[model samples]
Target: MKEILERRYTLTPFKKEIKGLKDAFRRASLRNLDSMRKRGFRPKNISYYEEVILGEKRYEELKGFSGRIIGYFCTFIPQELIYAARAIPIRLCSGFYDTVLVCEEILAKDICPLVKSSFGFKISASSYFELCDAVILPTPCDPKKKLIEILSDYLPVWVLKIPQDKTSSSKEIWLEEIKSLKERIEDFTKTKLTRQRLEETIKLIHKRQTLFRQLYEIRRANPYLMGGRDFLLVIQTSFYDDIERWIDKTEELCKQLSKEKTHFKTDEKIKILVTGSPIIWPNFKLLNIIEDLGAEIVCDDLCSGTQSLYNLVEPDEPTTDVMLGAIADGYLLSSVCPCFIENNDRIDRVLNLIEEFRVGGVIYHSLRLCQLYEIESHRLRLILKEKKIPMLTIHTDYSQEDTEQIKTRVEAFLEMLKR
Candidate 1:
């Protein structure tokens, strides 16, 4: 019965169109993939993320139970609201290069790769997004803010206005937006966001993030217990995978990791904190280079990494209002995204993390056309310079043309940090 329901739910009405798009994508992607492999850019979590992409393992099992899957893009959109409404929230951000060619044809050639891939995967009827009821996107960056207009033509879309300022005025405005989002969600699912349901869901999400932080804690205290690649796999998986199941497995890993002893002293390896644009799974270019150099990424400020685990919504009361306030306060106010205007907190947190994690330097990576991160890089540079911290910022796209260039720069950065 479960298998039948899953097959039925995922079956697309526009099968012919979907098939043709996918077939075209495969041919174009194979050529690029061969070159990428030749450049030695294999993703660290290929098997796991591939399974997640295909929706064949855990994602399949969960979608087997229900069809109310809500696809979301950024961490700014809370999952607890969807969970509280008795729907599965799956992250729909795309880091897959295979769809980039197909995407570039439809969208502008210079638009961000992430939007292109995500929109392409949707139109192509990819397994992960085929059955979603709606997509919730926050207007954080310019590309993302404009993306909803195009996406709404295909799917039921909800947009949340992310503030450009951290002022008291913006906080109040954002709180109202959260309220509007809740009402929109309620309308979409035909389910009311009750106090009891919201509280229970908040607890579940809180537990999940707590366990995620515990994994990071192990890495911070004993970097040998968890490598950079393995740590990121766990972090990225939580965005779309079943929250409760991910929590159980992460806690189990945390338990096993906690029992392990550090074979080497803290000074044995160069610890680093990574920041800038989100580096989703299968795009582990920066992580691959950094970890390959014997440096451990003790922490990061990426949405796909530590930022997802950075804040906890410690509500004094588990009421819906309190939990909503907590989510707004923790996820938005505490965020380090370059989209915000008054963003000194982002650089301040970087310096604090450098001291806390004893990070040797910061590697700030930005994808092409991502102006916010590149602009923020200048500000972050001034702060790092004053603090006398070594840093490097890399800019590139999905193509592996600049692999050697980045490798040389990373080697130089590591050497500088060592001296």
Candidate 2:
């Protein structure tokens, strides 16, 4: 029944239209690229404003404005906090004015370079700290903790402690932390965040998230109606501070997908799910590499992928309460990345996706020296092996520069899966 569903999805005429829609997006991206450059922009990484028009200037330019600026150390911080504070909350992932130089001073050099690079970017410029009113660090991992320690020394850093244990008590800890986070935000911003504001933010976010999830569903509808590569661009374009534009893109993409139908070629027998921690940025090359090797990347469970697909917000609930609930839940909990946690349910979720998708294999991407994900890689391989699922694990920084070796391993893995 599942295979039949997959087959029908891939071959339908709708899939063809969907594929066309994906191609149209690429052309659109290119067409806009020159204009984007004129607007002082780049690709999905930095030109998000150009991509969606979130006001012409960079988000940090409002220096004279008395609005507080909240910085989240990762992607998981509740956006409602920023909305509630009447402040701009930016994820501390990238696009800083300076090179990172604080990692070595605060953290062990043995950790990943990404963390180091982020620190370098921040410390490279003095103005980096000037725009930040406070830092929200979710206790998701050691690197994040170290990042908080370093940033706190320079600015107001509030740490939201996440529970290491995967139990009912975890929810309790999260609720208390949410309250604490609320108080902290109010204290620092001198803005009274009422329940109504929080609730409003929740409704807005929920609407946005629902559209985001639907876009993924369209992307996931297979024969490859939508190019996963293009789909990733849609996802990464939302990471920055453009809430309105993000929502617009989501709606537009959904409308486009709904009107079209298409699927990717099924010439390659091998199909797999790419698994890893949160992909800090979108990398379309990973999808390209697999397809180039006569293999199909049917799905991914990365943070920037399926793991981001979340449930809907209740319409009857108060917006702030829903916002509070979202925080208490792990939806926006940046620190609870499955790679950094010891939860078996996450592992099980991966396996289930693999099974339901009828994936022939699993490709585990572990960032170099990303200790938690590396550990999970080994355990996952064992579990997959027991299930007779061929697996390949690769370690590298998330750079397109490493494509050659990654391609080789991916090709070899697909060959093994084929056999």
Candidate 3:
């Protein structure tokens, strides 16, 4: 009993090693300024990460500091839109490393773990909440919507609502909402989104997107020149880093990856489709686990992956209309994830991916206490089972504390499939 408890409670050597590597990478991210400059890595996404790091660094650098900062909650909302509007869009991500001095009462105990963690971080004086000027949350889930409503009193609040139905296009509805959002931002920042400013923003965004495509193409080439885990870090960094410099590093990496292949030639490997939420950068343990098991994650239904498939409007397309159209089409897809409201489109997406990839099994990962994914997992599993496809369900947190259990379950599932 003692041995089992110890093994379960104690962090594994492998986990520790992975964490150390990530820490080193993070430190490298901070120290490689000269190399980044030499490589002409002027990605705006890199700057985004730097800005947040710098925000915290600036506070630490100065003896005592206090100023306006903004917090944005939820993912896949195109925060660059907010940045162009002149407000720092800090993602409200947190974990167990927090003290809940202020957020406990407002957020409630039953709220989503990530939201609770954010509140705890705010209360604990983790510096994330201390610098927040406002909190913007999109309607990704019911809990999040409620979170935003409650947070309005505590801070400036902005709610980005996604259209509910995809059967009939809601282009006009979304366009109106964008116009309303524009008005609200103008009021909030006292900055106007002039034609020139919008154009500049578009150009910067276009450059970043182009670089992202190039990087992904390199990853997709046979033998996956870059490891899945490393590629995920680059993706996560791209989200918050300075886009231009990140682009430069990505371009360099692409040149290196071009000569390599993406596949492994191992026998008895199970080809799997990773079905679940987006596995963003800096938190790629899940994908690494799959690869380590001799299972290939050939495809994914993550927003961080396929969700960025649609291209932005052409330069000649009317800016307002194109932007609105892009937002609507992207968000209003039939395959929209359950984070908003689990609809039929998600099921269709599962079937489509399975057929397209010729996947042998599906690994369904839901973060611990992620209400949306957890609730939908059972139904998803039933559907897959009915289709005679093998499925594995694993729960995790961002910090990877439950990796061993997840791996055991995954191994067992793979073993069963082999028989």
TM-score leaderboard ranking: 1, 2, 3
* Candidate number with greatest lDDT: 1
What TM-score fits each model?
0.87, 0.76, 0.72
Candidate 2 off by > 4 Å:
1-66, 94-108, 126-131, 262-270, 282-288, 291-296, 309-316, 319-323, 330-336, 339-341, 398-402
- Give me the displacement of residue 144 in model 3, in angstroms: 0.7
Candidate order by decreasing lDDT:
1, 2, 3
Q: Write model 1 residue lDDT over 230-343, tens digit each, in one string.
A: 666667777767777677766667676666544445446788788888887566777777777777777888877788766787778876777888877877888878788778
Mind giving the per-residue lDDT tens digits that candidate 3 earns over 1-419?
A: 01101222322211001123224435534443322333221234344444434334544532232333457654445544565676555566543322222345544555555666566554444445556776666676776776665555455666667666544555466555656666666677778876566666667667766776676555444323433444444555544444556677767666655544323333235667776755543345677677776666656666555444324433565476565455445444533567544477777888987886577889887766677787887888998989999888777765546778878888888888777
Clashes of each: 0, 29, 33
RMSD of each: 6.6, 13.3, 11.0
Could you tell me the lDDT of residue 174 within candidate 1?
Answer: 86
Instruction: Say which candidate scores most in TM-score.
Output: 1
Report the candidate with higher TM-score, 1 versus 3. Answer: 1
* Residues 1-419 of candidate 2: C-alpha lDDT, one tens digit per residue: 01101222222111001123224333434543432233211123333434432322444454555677776765556667677778877655542111222445544667665566555545543223346777777766677766666655455668777677656677777777777778877877888889888777777778877887776666555525443444554555555545776787567656755665432344335667888755543224455677656665667776655554354444456656655775566443333265335667667778887877788888887777677787778878888889888888877764457889889888887777777
Error of 2 at 263 (Å): 6.5
Backbone clash total for model 1 is: 0
Score candidate 3 by lDDT. Answer: 0.57
lDDT of 1: 0.74
